[model samples]
Target chain A: MGIVSPGFSGRRRSGSELPPGQYLTRDFPVLSAGPTPHIRTEHWEFTVTTETGEATKWDWAALLALPADEITKDIHCVTRWSKLETNWKGVSLDTLLADVETSADYALVHSYGGYTTNVPMDDLLDGQAWIAYEYDGEPIDPEHGGPARLLVPHLYFWKSAKWVRGLVLSDNQDLGFWETAGYHEYGDPWKEQRYAGD
Target chain B: MTTDASYLDGNAAAGALSQVFAMDVTAAITQCNGCGQTGVFAESHVYVNAPGLVARCSGCDGVLLRVVTTPSDVYLDLRGLTYLRLPNP
Candidate 1:
């Protein structure tokens, strides 16, 4: 809230629409931690694994066959870029979990590239999230987490793990790939909780 | 392409690094503390996709540098490097 200092001096900001210190990047920047895994839609599957190890799976076609919703939302990244009014289409998690059973209170979202992030189980339900496969009316690009990515717009974009392959329900919370390194456990952008202590 | 599509050389970090160092930090020679491999900072395997910018040693894949810029903070970690010698520019 102080006058723009040295660290943030490099980036531009308007503050009216963005969460805290974020800047609006017209171009969606690709920030990846590892090599991209080439996954075919035919080979893509999403699994929901409970703490008891019970699993329910859905293949690409089956997923598309389920009810889908068109969404327009803003996404904020921990690295400080926010894209607004992005459109996405995907099946709601409420519908996906309708048939699945779980007593766990936490969920650890995992991506195909070995990336994992944790969130409260409640965050995935009641219209809070989706397994988004389409962006801007087109099939989402593989590099953008296509086949599908978990879209949890309320949290930082990283929590919406790209190449999302599964959600592991847990009775206990666990720190994921970035969380273990220092990212906030529950990345609420409005609160500006970007790091461990923040 | 999203920055996620590829890993770039450390030179890609210039604009971001400019926030901290007055000179071009990517031109400095660095030695990895983990594997002891030495190279110009530009040659490190730099992954720009993530919560931050992560540069890893080309030799052993140890993290050579990590830069995370928040709204009000900039975290630069060189723990993976034993030393960095700035080239006379």
Candidate 2:
């Protein structure tokens, strides 16, 4: 409710966006733990591994062979910024998982340069997510997780991991980077779940 | 805001940090406890586009300050700074 940080202030949130306690931002700000890894398209690959260790992988060309859809959706970040109507193009999870079989209930998305985030398997299926390679009509910038990234628009944007490489399906919901760092396990902006206790 | 660097300095967060601090904390001189590198707060690496804002020492990549602001509470930790002397007068 107030600022207690060393010489720090806070931003107020107002407006009926997709989430509570979030402000609207037009500019797409770049966020990263270290640096933006430049993954060459030719060397890029996407994979889906089941709990039993069976995996289906697709390189750049193979991924493009799948049907690509243009998607426009609103994305909310737990950091308190809601960027609405972000346009993306990629293969939907439904298309990607149509042939794959698995009984796992969770998915841990891994990215290049060692970044990871977990999402409920249900949140990823039934056309809920995509392996988005394009943003706003251009190949995603490396700084914004370009080449390819997860596009789980419903949850907090962190679930849409940048520089996404592949996924490892599991029965257990292993906490990812932020989740292990006290961020809410399931970050649903509507519920105002930004922290662990909340 | 280019592909050249994935991160930006402390200036980008001035607006959000302004809500609580009357003065610009980015102008403060902070010495990192890890590497003993001293610089203006504005020169530190600020990862602001996340669930929270984490300012790290550009010298040794040590976390200088961590901030997470929820609807009902504000959490700030400055354990990485040996001393943070703000300018006034």
Worst 10 residues of 1 chain A by lDDT: A4-13
Candidate 1 C-alpha lDDT tens digits along A1-198: 446421122333455868998988778887687666668888899999999999999999999999888777788988889987778999899999998878899999988866789989888898889999999999888778887999999899989989999999999999887776567899999999889889
Provide per-model DockQ scores: 0.23, 0.18
Per-residue CA lDDT of model 2 for B57-84, tens digit only, reads 7787677776666666656667789998
Give the range of the ten consecutive residues with the poorest summed lDDT in model 2 chain B.
B1-10
**How would you class the docking of model 1?**
incorrect
Chain A of candidate 1 scores what in TM-score?
A: 0.91
Q: What's the TM-score of chain B for every model shown?
A: 0.89, 0.83
> How do the residues A1-198 of candidate 2 rate in per-residue lDDT, one tens digit apiece?
333421111343335744878888898877676556789999898999999999999999998899887887778887678887778899899899888889999999998866689999999987788999999899998888989999988898889998888999999999886776568889888998888888
Candidate 2, DockQ score (0 to 1): 0.18
What are the clashing pairs of model 1? A30-B3, A30-B4, A31-B49, A31-B50, A32-B49
Error of 2 at B48 (Å): 4.6
